[model samples]
Target chain A: MNILVCISHVPDTTAKINFTADGSALDPAGVQFVINPYDEFGLTKALHIKEAQGATITVLNVGGPETEPTLRKALAIGADQAVRINATPTDAITVAKSIKNHIQANAYDLIICGQESIDYNGQQVPAMLAALLDVPMVNACVGLTIDGSTATAKAEIDGGHATYTANLPMVIGGKKGLVEEKDLRIPNMRGIMTARTKPLSVEEGLSGSNTAAKAFRKPAAKSAVKMVAPDQVNELVRLLHEESKSI
Target chain B: MILVFVESWNNQFKKASFEAVSYARKWADMAGCSVKAVVSSGASNPESLAQYGADSIATLDLAATGPGMAGQLSTMMDGVQGVVVAGTAVGKTLAPTLAALIDGALSTNTTSTPSSVGPVVVERGAFSSKGIETIALSEGMPIVSFVPNAIGIEEKAGAGAIESGSASGTDKVAVSEVSVASGKVALPEAEVVVSAGRGLKGPENWGMIEELAEVLGAATACSKPVSDIGWRPHSEHVGQTGIQVNPNLYIAIGISGAIQHLAGVSASKTIVAINTDPEAPFFKAADYGIVGDAFDVVPRLIEELRAFKAAN
Candidate 1:
């Protein structure tokens, strides 16, 4: 089996979000970048698949040269190879098309990526990529098992979850439940040394975004808490009903 | 006309369906267009859409998978300039695929109505609610997913005429089974949410939390550690890595509030925190806070709420 994992470079969840002076783009200054936490689960699941069954895993990212570090981390964790599409992703549509272009040029049996990047949280690329390729795509996937040429996957819905079956050459958008947090791999010294020798390829990517961000505005700052004594349960209820009108 | 994709399960229209139809109506009025509500199949309360703004109802056997539905919707465009879908799990999966299939512009999880019609312009939450972004779409057909509970439900009284259409069933990614809890309130549409964390000690103490939720008509959620340790199901977990919830009021009990957890819920209109430690980080972001043990405070709060409900 050949699996391709799509990695996204995003700000750490704890980092403060700030935009440029023009309010048109994100300000990367002083922001720490990391592999989007969601994609880590998918990559770990791919490594497990490769370990159990004979398979080769290729980690892919669509960004400028800055994203190579994240792709190398995926390699250090246990991917066999890496590919970098040399383009800054402008929108979900542009990124999906770029990935589709790469997938057409190279064949892979299974594709994996996070449901959404933490920074944008659009949750668009995987489904859009599947549409562009005219293939099956499953998002919010928590459980997945492969049998021969078929893949059985479990995805979360509104009230519960649903199970689905799809053939190979499909895409999966995995999240935390795909693998236990404890099972995620860390780069050991030997693994990091080996990853430095692994193959890393770069290719020009397609451009043009359907939607363009015009401005960025910050949410209003939260006010200090209005504390009520622990014993004042009635007063709290009264405030919730009379003052806030929330109840 | 604006096409609104309304999703349904177990022969009932989901709460998100009403919100989408209502938003489509408002957008249609602003854009000077008519509204059509499209259902995949098996919606028992299709007429309720008329209470919102759907002028007509078009029922089709929409293929269950995103790719399949995108293919079906491509053929049904029929001079429609755009479509509006709820930002539910199903709608988010389908909107982008449909946009890609038809070579249209796409926007998901939009918080506001588009400021312009053709070459639509709108604002959406970005950076996990830390920032609001304005996006402009110049593509011919614009597809958008309106976030659940972001817009208020309105009544416009549509004609609600029903039209039937055939299905182009795509066999890819066939749904083998679906399991949904019967009466639980879904996190997305909940107006109020009651959440607990490891500070509650164990799952055995969840009865009080559930009681509080029941009295408030709220959904029950948990922090990451509570779910990780098997004290609560993963579905209830809300954090940067878990589900993001934007309820009108959020009540956090026994949670110390890590940055990741705050990212998922900071969008809430009001937040109340109950924790044993005064120095818990959640208090910094909450509108109201109480420094006390959950076991001591929750039962009393539940009793107060019940009495308050009786008098009202």
Candidate 2:
């Protein structure tokens, strides 16, 4: 079986997020970039499938050259090959369209992607890819298993979980529960050396107009906390009910 | 007409559905149009929607056929200028499918209402609510998914004309079983939430958290570490990689408030943190705070809340 994993490059979770001088874009001056945390879970799951089911995992990303390091990191983690779509992902539709075009040219039995990128948190690409490809897609999936042409997955719903079954040529938006932290493999010296020589391909993608961000702003700063002494707990309840009217 | 998709589960309108109707009403008023609500669960209270400014309600009986709510709603999108929906579990899947089907521009988890003029524009959280971006869509029609609680629910009386519709069925996927979390309020709809972290020490100590939540009628949540260790169900996890909640009040107990955890609760209107360590990062983001152990703080708070309620 052949598997495709889509990844994104985002700032580290601990990185302090700031805006540019004009407040139009993210201030990348001191932010440290890393593979999106959720995407790492996707890659880890893909590697598990590669190890257990003997499938070739190809990592894909839709971005410019700055994303190559992230893709190479996926290779080190255990993807058989890497492919970078030479485009700036301005919006979800553009990224999905380009991925759809690429997938149409290449065949894969299963497609995997993180539930949502940490940066945008849009959670659009996986569904859009499913729509454009005319395939079944499961979002917020925690467990995925493939057997021959049938795939059974468990996904989180409104109040509980629901199990779903779909045929091959499907998409899955994976989250943390897909694999535990201990299962995630880090790149060793040997794996790092091998990743440097692994096949990484770059290809052009389709062109399309998408929604543009006109401006950027920060959320209002939180106010100073009203601290109540530990002993005066009932005062807190009165304040919440009368002053805030929140309870 | 601005179409708002009202999501229902087990034949009732979710809280997000009311907020969606209210949000669409704002846009409709700005555009001098009307708001039409489309219900996907095949059952609805048109009166409830009418109170929230829905001019008409279209009920699609897709529950029996199963899993085609998006396809059915796509048929109703003809000539609709703008589409609105709640960012609920089902809406997360349905809106994108509908937008792709109609070749419309889609924006998810929008924090601000778009201006009612042409070339639809809105503000959405980017980088996990760390920054906000003002987006403009000039392509096909615009579809916006309002984050849960992004817009407050309000009542504006309207003529509640009800219409019934149906769509053809396809058995691509079947839901084998559903076990709804009964009795407890779901996190997304809860106005008040009490979430705990490792400071409580073990799963056995969850009684106090539940007691506090029970006293305040709030939902219970946990930090990623607590869930990761299996002390709490994954559904209770709220953070960057976990479920995102936007409640009116979020009380974090024993949580140090990692950035990832803050990313999820930052949208909450008021935050109160109770931690033994005074310097826990969560204090920086809280509206109210207490420096004490959960064992000492939670029980007392719960008792105080009960007393306050009795007095009222």
Candidate 3:
């Protein structure tokens, strides 16, 4: 079986988020970039399946030259090869189209991606890709197993969980617990050096996209925290009812 | 015409759907157009859609039509100027598909009403939660999905008409079976949540967390490590890669808050951290902090809550 994993290059979780002078784009001046944490689960799960079921994993990303370091990290981890659609992913549709272009040529048995990229948090890419490919897709997959030609997966729903069984050529958006963080295989020195020699294909991005971020601003600061003493339960209830009106 | 997809499960309109309807109604009123709600299940009560300001409700029987439900929804969007859906998982899937099918743009997770722009101008989160972005969709008949719990649900008096529709054929995708986890409240829908981490020691000690959650009418969640160690179900994991929740209250017990964990719950309205470690990073983000041992403090906290409840 051939598996494809989608990865995103994002600011390290610890990095301070700052805006540019004009506040139009993210200010990545001194921020450290890493593979999106959510995507790590996708890559790790694919590697586990590859090791257990003899499947090959190919990592894909849509970003510019800066994303190559993260792509190489994916290769070091366990991907057999990597593809970089050289483009600044502007919107969900453009990113989906880019992935679809690669998927059209290669018949992947399974495509796995993070539920959402930590950078943009635009959780639409996986569903959009599945729609473009016209294949069955599951989101927030927490557990997965393969039985012969069918793949059974458990997806985290709003209140409960839903189990889905789909044939080959299905897409899954992974959340936490799909694979343990300890199970992540970090490539050794040799693997890292050799990953540079592996295939790192790049293609032109689609143009003429209409969706663009017109302006960016910060959410208004939340009101000052009102401390209701532990003994003020009735007061809290009254405030919630009459003042906050939340109830 | 503007279309609103009123999401319902088990024959009840979700609170998020009410929020969506309120948004759709506001937009429709501004655009001088009629708003109609569509539901996938025929079992849904169409009358409830009117209370939230929908002018009409259309129930499409798609149990037989399978997973091409998006295509069917797109067919309904044929004459509509715009479509509004709750930015839940289902809407996340359907809205983009409908947009792609119509060759239009989709603005997802919008927080506010559109500006006076031609298509629509809306605000969406960008760069994690670091910033908000204002985007204008110029494409005709844009599809927009509002983030769940982002907008408040309001009610308006209305006597809307109900229409029934059916789609031919069966869904290509079939839900072979549903294995629902036995829990009092779903994590995503819970207004309050109590989560634990490695600070709780073993899975057996989870009784305290569960007790506190039960007292507060909140769902139980665990950090990634707890889920990784199989102490808690993966469905209960909350983090960057897990389910993001924005409940009214989030109580972190014994969890030395990690940034990944904070990312999931930061949207929560009030955060209360109870940990033995005073220097835990969660204290900086929490609205209330109690520096004490969980084993010693949790029981007392529960006792206090029970006593407080009885008095109230």
Candidate 4:
């Protein structure tokens, strides 16, 4: 079986978010970039499938050359090959379109991606790709298992989890329960060396919809926390009900 | 007409659906358009939406369509100017697909209502809720999925005529059964949330959390470690890799805030952290802090909440 895993380049979750001087774009000056944490979960799941089911894993990302290090990291984590769609991903729709075009050219039995990227948090690409490619998809899947050509996935909803079944050539938007953090593979010295020589290819992508961001601003700074002693817990309740009007 | 997808499960309108209705109603009033609703489920209560500004409700018998409601939504988006949906799991799937099908723009987890900022625009969290990004739809209709609790739900009586329909054909994928936590407030729609981390030590100590949540009418959540160890359901895990919530009030019990955890909840209107260690990172992000033991503090906190409720 052939598996495709899509990853995104995002600022570290702990990075300080800042807007440009004119407040039109994100200021990348002091931010440290890393593979989106959710995408890491998807990549780990793909590697697990590769190990257990003997599938070739190909990692894909639509980004500029700056995303190569993240792609190499996926290779080190055990992807068979890496393909970079040399395009500045504007929005989820365009990104999914590029992915759909790529997947149409090179077929895959399964496609995996995070529920949403940490940066934009649109949570749209997986669904859009599935719709564009006319394939079945499971959103926010927590547990996934592939038995031959049949795939059964467990996805948690508002109150309970839904069990879904679909054939191969499907898409899954994965969350935490799909793969545990402890199962993530770190690049060893040998794996890093091998990643340097791994097959990395770049391809042009389709220019699709342009969803633009007008401006960006940081969230309002949190005020100093109101300290309430353990015995004065009721005061906190009073504050919530009366002052904040939240209760 | 402004179209809003009323999200229902098991034929019941979820709280987020009402929120979506109220949100659309406000925007529609501004746009001088009627508010129309579409429900894919066998909605138990279609008339309830009428009081919340729905002029008409289109109920679709999507039982045969399975979980993929995008086709039905695409058909419903016809002749609609602005589309509003609750940013729940189902809406997240349908809105994007509809946006793509219409060659329009889509914005999820909107922190505020879409307004005309030289074009249709919506404010949504970016970079894991650390910042807010104002997105403009380049052209075509705008599909906006509002985050729960961001827009207040209000009542305004309107015509509420129900029209029934169904998807033309079946979908490729099929959901065998929908497993939802019965009788509990869903995390996404909850206005108040009380989340526990490993600080509580074990699942057996969850009684107070449940009691507090019950008294306050809030939802219960947990940290990644708590869920990974089977202490809580994975559905209740809130973090960057888990469910991101924007509740009005978020209380953390025994959970030292990790960056991943904070990423999911920083957009909350107010945060209260109760941890034994005052230096826990969650304090920096919280509006209130109580440095104490959960065993001693949680029960007392529950008692205080009960007393406050009784007084009110």
Candidate 5:
């Protein structure tokens, strides 16, 4: 089977969020970028599948040259090839369409992506890609197993979880439940050495609807904390009811 | 007309559905349009949406599950100026599919009704919920999914006339239900969350936490360390890297408030922190703080909450 894993390069989750001088974009100064945790989970799952079933895994991203290092990291983690759709990804719709263009040129038996990127959290690209491909998709997929042309997937729902059975040429949007954090692989010395010679290709892409960020601002600042004594349960409840009106 | 996609799970209309409908109804009032609710099949109590601003309701035929469901929703786009969806698993799937089908701009985690509708301006969570990004869509239909619990449920009477929508044929895939509820509230949909950290000692000590959560009608959540060490399932983990929740009230007990954890829970409306360490960083970010031991404080909290509920 052939698998394509989509990854996003986002700011490290621990990085302090700040905006540019004009508030049009994120201030990259003093920020560290890493693979979106969700996407990393998906990539790690694909590696598990590849190791077991002998599938060729390819890592794909729709970003500029700056994202190549992220792609390289995926390659080091065991992907056979990496493809970069050379464009500044504007929104999920456009990014999905662009990835669809790449998929149209080359087919894959299975596609895996994070439920949503940590930065934008749109949760659209994977669904959009499946829609554009007109294939069945399982979002928030936790457990997945492939048997020949069939795939069994389990996903999270509002109250509980649901299981889905779809054939090949389907999409799976993976999340934290798909794999534990400890399962995430770090690049070994040999893997990193081999990554330098691995295939990393870029292609021009199509664009769809553009949903640009008009402005950015921090969430409302919090007021000073009202510290209560340990025995102030009654007062705390009163404050929650009267002051915050949140009870 | 504004189309509000009402999602259901486990044979009931999710609370998020009504929240989204109410969200769209307010937007419709501002935009000078009517609200048309299209609900999925098997969602019980479809008419109750009338209480939450659904002027008319349309249900997808029972057989419309996969691509057929998408096509059925597409057929409802005749006069839809914009689309509203809840920020649930189902909405995340339908939002982008609808955007692709309509060739429209889509925004998820939208915080409010349109401030003004001409350009369709709205705010969405950004940077792992640390910031808000205002997005404006000029052309085509604006497809937006509301952040769960961000815009609290509001009610305004509506007609709620039910109608049947078209259903395309089935597909090759077969989807089935796996497990039902664990008798606990879902984390994202919870208005109040009782979250803990490793400071609680172990998974065996969760009885008090569960008792407090039960009394408060809140979901239970954990910090990354708790889930990492297997004290809690990954689904219960809340942090920058895990589920980011924006509930109305979030109570963090035995948590020291890592930067990553704060980034996720900071979007909550009100926060209360309880920890033995007075210097724990969570206190700075919390609206209220208590320096106490969980074993002592949690039971007291549960008792206080139960009594408070009885009184109120």
Candidate 6:
């Protein structure tokens, strides 16, 4: 089986997010980069499927050279090969188009990606990919299993859950409960050394008008904390109604 | 016309769907147009959408078809200027796919109105709820998915016209199935949530947490470490990578609030924390804090809740 896993390079979750001077884009200085956490779930799930069924996992990314490290990390985590679309990943449309162009010639059995990237939280690329390919897609899948040519997956729905079944050549987005942490593979030292010798191809990004960040600004600061004594329930309610008006 | 995706489960409209319809209605009013709601299930009562300000409702008999929500919604996006959906997992999944199918731009988890311009501008959450961002979509209709529970629902009386639609059933690809746990409230839909962390000691002590949750009609959650160690299922993990929730009241027990965990619940209306450590990080983010052991404080709190319920 052949699988394509989408990956994105995002700032580490612990990094303090800040804007550049003039507030146009993300301030990259002092920001540590990492594979998006949600995407890690996709990569690990792909690796698990590959190990279980002898599938080949290909990692795809839409970013500049800065994202090569993320691709290498996927390689270290067990992807057989990687493809990097050389671009800044300006918006979801551009990224999706680049992916579509690259995969148009190849037929994939399964396409996996994170539900959303932590940095922008756009949550559009996988869906966009599925639409562009005209294939079935499921997002935020919490569980998945294969039965012959059919794949059964559990996707998170509002207030409940839904089970979906799609044939081969479908897309899925990863979320928690879909893949356990123990399933994550850390490439051995030899695998890390072998990754340098593996194929990591870079393709030209599609040319298109991309959305530009006009300005960046910080959110309004929260007010000082107010203390309410445990016995002052009535007072709290009165204050919420009269002063806070948030009730 | 503005299109709203009315989310439903077990033939009931979700609370978030009401907000979605309200938002679409408000936008339609601003745009000098009408709002239409689309449901995947024909079994749904379209007339009820009128009370929530939907000018019309469209239902597709696809409940028994499959889980190709994006494919089904895409066929119905004709003559629509804008699309609004609840930014739940399903919405987050389908909205982008729909946008891509239409070759449009999308904004996720938006919290405020879009700016009127050639290219639409929308405000959305960023930096794990630490900031808000205004993004501009320069091409096609903007597909906006609003965060669940962020927008308040408002009712307006109107006789919304109902329409039925059909589409050719497509072959299923990548079939999916779910086995829901019995007697457990889905964390996302719960009004109250009781969560614990490593401070709880072991899975054996989860009975206290369950008891508190049961008494309050709440769901149970665990911190990342707790879930990582198998004390709780990954479905109950609340953090950046896990399920983010914004319930009316959230109670954290025996947990030191990590920044990741706080990001998930900081949007909640009210938060209370109980931990043996006076300086647990959760206290700083909590609306109320009690410095005590869960072994001592949980039973008392449960008793107080029971007394309060009985008295009321």
The top-ranked prediction according to DockQ is 1
Q: Candidate 6 residues B120-139, lDDT tens each?
A: 67787766665567788777
Query: Measured against the native two-chain assembly using Cα atoms, what DockQ does each of the candidate structures obtain, in the order listed?
Result: 0.83, 0.75, 0.46, 0.76, 0.74, 0.46
Q: What is residue B211's positional error in candidate 3, in angstroms?
A: 2.6
Span of ten consecutive residues with least summed lDDT in model 1 chain A: A238-247
Instruction: Give the residue spans of candidate 2 off by over 4 A.
Output: B63-67, B169-171
Docking class of 2: medium
| Chain B TM-score of every predicted model | 0.95, 0.96, 0.91, 0.92, 0.94, 0.91
Per candidate, the number of residue pairs that clash is 0, 1, 6, 7, 0, 16
lDDT (10s digit) by residue, model 2, range A21-130: 89878888898888887778888988888778889999999999989999888898888999999988888888998999999999999999998999988888888888
Candidate 3 TM-score to native: 0.91
**Residue A146 C-alpha lDDT in model 4:** 95
Q: Provide the global lDDT of candidate 3 against the true structure.
A: 0.77
Q: TM-scores across all candidates?
A: 0.98, 0.97, 0.91, 0.96, 0.96, 0.90
Task: Name the lDDT value of residue B251 in candidate 2.
Answer: 95
Candidate 3 stretches with Cα past 4 Å from truth are A147-149, A219-247, B63-67, B115-117, B168-170, B307-312
Candidate 4, residue B224: the lDDT equals: 88
User: Can you write out model 4's per-residue Cα lDDT over A1-247, one digit (the tens) per residue?
Assistant: 9999999989988787888999988889999888887788888888888888799999999999999999999999889899999898888888898999889999899999998888988999988888888888888888899999899988876667888889888998888778886777788988899999999999987675657888998888888988999888988888888777878
Which lDDT tens digits does candidate 3 get at residues B1-312? 788877776667788888888888888887888888887665457788788898887887654212366777766755688888887766776677667656677887676777754768888876556567888787557778887777777787555888788654234355656655565877866788989999999999999898988887888999988988889977788876677787887888888888778877877777777778878988877766677778877777677667666766
Native interface contact recovery, model 2: 0.72
Candidate 6 chain A worst ten-residue window by lDDT:
A232-241
Q: What's the lDDT for residue B293 in model 4?
A: 96
lDDT against the true structure, each candidate? 0.89, 0.85, 0.77, 0.85, 0.86, 0.77
**Candidate 1 residue lDDT tens string, A39-59:** 999999999999899799999
Report how far off residue A23 is in candidate 6 (Å). Answer: 2.3
